[model samples]
Target: MKKMMITALSVVMAFSLAACGTKSAPDSAAPQTGGATPAPDKKEVTLKVGATAAPHAEILNSIKAKLKEQGVNLEVKEFTDYVQPNVQVFEKQLDANFFQHTPYLEQFNKDKSMNLVTVTGVHIEPFGGYSQKIKKIDELKDGATVAIPSDPSNGGRALALLEKNNLIKLKEGVGVKGTVRDVLENKKNLKFKELEAAMLPRTLGEVDLALINTNYALEAKLVPTKDALFIESNDSPYVNILVSRPDNKDSEAMQKLAKALTSEDVKKFIDEKYKGAVVPAFK
Candidate 1:
């Protein structure tokens, strides 16, 4: 009896020891607490932009590094003519373009039945009148032929500049919508020849005076501040802008581009590199 009781007690003690030796599984039912939430995934973006060669592309290239830092890859396609850039953007071949102003964009949208919008104003290339035959506006001979851009948007700008400098008089409130027919007075009997904007620079010797866009003037190695007879006022409404489709106007990539283009570095770059040829429109 005594041996039986001792064996039973030993078995009970052995089971208790084994139970203590065995480790308990973690409390799987308990909620985890005090840990950081994972960060959101950032989407990588590549923005393909179309721009003019001299100032527009140059300016876009200047911000390539900055955009990269913001996780955007910039692909700048150089365009010599203005039409293709907008067409490409409208067709979704490019993300955005930086070669035109608000007035031109407005006319283009109307003419093409598309919906493109401005992201931001980048710079102003003043419209000016250039001449090799005449030294001043007053020296223009009677019946002297003056060449202007044939496109309605730019032709209107040329006429506005001519009117501003007293070279001619446009009818009241005719502003940017003015045409050659809108001329109220032609005091110098200036014969008007409307030509393509790009051809105006080459026709400098042929015409008494050529009203030229500052971009083409620069391309022809003509400095508006020095060579132009008169230039658009600093307050001119024709400030060039960064443009995109209306739907993409608020996209992350477009917003980043607009921010980078109007950044202090870009402003400084324009002021220094182009001198006064391209004026910053941000301020």
Candidate 2:
């Protein structure tokens, strides 16, 4: 009886020890409620924007690190031409674009029937008159071919620059809408050759002088403030803007992007990097 009782006790002890030796599952390994995973540590917002290559893309690239700290991811798509950015934005492919000024945006909307609007003015890339053949505007020979942008808005801007420099006289009240037909007086008798804005830089040796947009000038390794014979004034109305769809104008992402663009750091970057070729338009 005693041996049977001891055998039963030994059997019970062995079973308990075996059970204790078998490791139980860890608390962390336990199944979560409804089999759902926990949320991520950080929430991220992404904003994709279209911009021109030089200063616009460069500026956006500079702020990427800063935006990341705010849990905002900035994706900048470089565009060579001015048209596609707006098209992409209107089609909802891009969240915003940072290449055009208000005048260009307005004209684009009117012409294309798009609903894009400016979120904020970021920078001003003054149009410049670059020439390899002449050192000064007055040095041009009679009937010297001057290249200007073929786009109506930019063409008018070119005319305005000419009128500002007294090389030509535009019709009264033509202002930003001036065209070749609006030329009232051509004192220099300078012939105007209209080409795509991006091609103006390549035509420097071809034309006596080319009215080059500052962005393209930078891309072609020409500094508007230093290389151009003449440049637009600082107070010029052609300030480059950040544009968004009307519905997204007040979104958090747009606001954050606008803030990042107009931040003092960006202003400093523009001042240091562009060296007056691109000026911060924000106050």
Candidate 3:
């Protein structure tokens, strides 16, 4: 009987040591569940936002700590392509996205049934022509090929910009989703080679000129102010925008984030960092 008791106690002691040695939940994660529903568990909210690498992601990174103070956590995921962010937000994978603009968003919703909506206007990255072949706008040849983004809205933006600088001409009121097909007159007869927005900078060396998006240009280390043959007006309606799901349009999380984006600190960051390539649209 004494031998039996000693064996049982030894087994218990071994189990206790095994339990102590094995990994378990950290003490900080311990539940404080009492009778009263645990005070809502402090509501640890997380927001996942998608954006382009440079200015959009960089801009969000700058304000992430500020957001953490308000009981919010931010995850800024970067994408090289434009289409996925809107699709991700539509599929409810992302909380929000900050890229593209009002017109593009409208066209995307109409075409893809994504139902995406803009929450706030961010900065406009002026579309412009960059070229290793031509030092000035006047050097564009009659049939020289220039690369442009393939997406309809941005293509129109690039076309409009080229026209603005006397590089081409278009029908009146082509708006943001305009393309080369909308051009009523091409005074220069510039042959446009449409490529992905991310690929335009790579085409700069091969083509006489390329109409590059600001974000893509920024990605390729091409600054619009210093490298472009010509640029679009920053005041153009085709500015980049911050977007969210249509259902979440009025959510408090979005409101807090939008307010934070338009704060003076963000405005100052845009003005100082991007120079004139990016401009605060909040004011």
Number of the top-ranking candidate, with TM-score as the measure: 2
lDDT of 2 by residue, 112-159 (tens): 998899899999999999999989878988888999999889999999
Alpha-carbon RMSD to native, per candidate: 7.2, 3.9, 7.7
lDDT of each: 0.90, 0.91, 0.84
Over 4 Å off, model 1: 1-43
Cα lDDT, model 3, residue 97: 94
Measured by TM-score, how close is model 1 to the native structure?
Answer: 0.84
For each predicted model, how many residue pairs clash, with residues at least 3 apart or on different chains?
A: 0, 0, 1
**TM of each candidate vs. truth:** 0.84, 0.89, 0.83
Q: Which ten residues in a row have the lowest lDDT in candidate 3?
A: 35-44
lDDT of 1 at 93: 98
- Measured by lDDT, the strongest candidate is 2
Candidate 2 vs 3: which has more TM-score: 2
Arranged by lDDT with the best first, the candidates are: 2, 1, 3
- Would you list the clashing residue pairs of candidate 1? none
Query: Which residue segments of model 3 deviate by more than 4 Å?
Result: 1-41
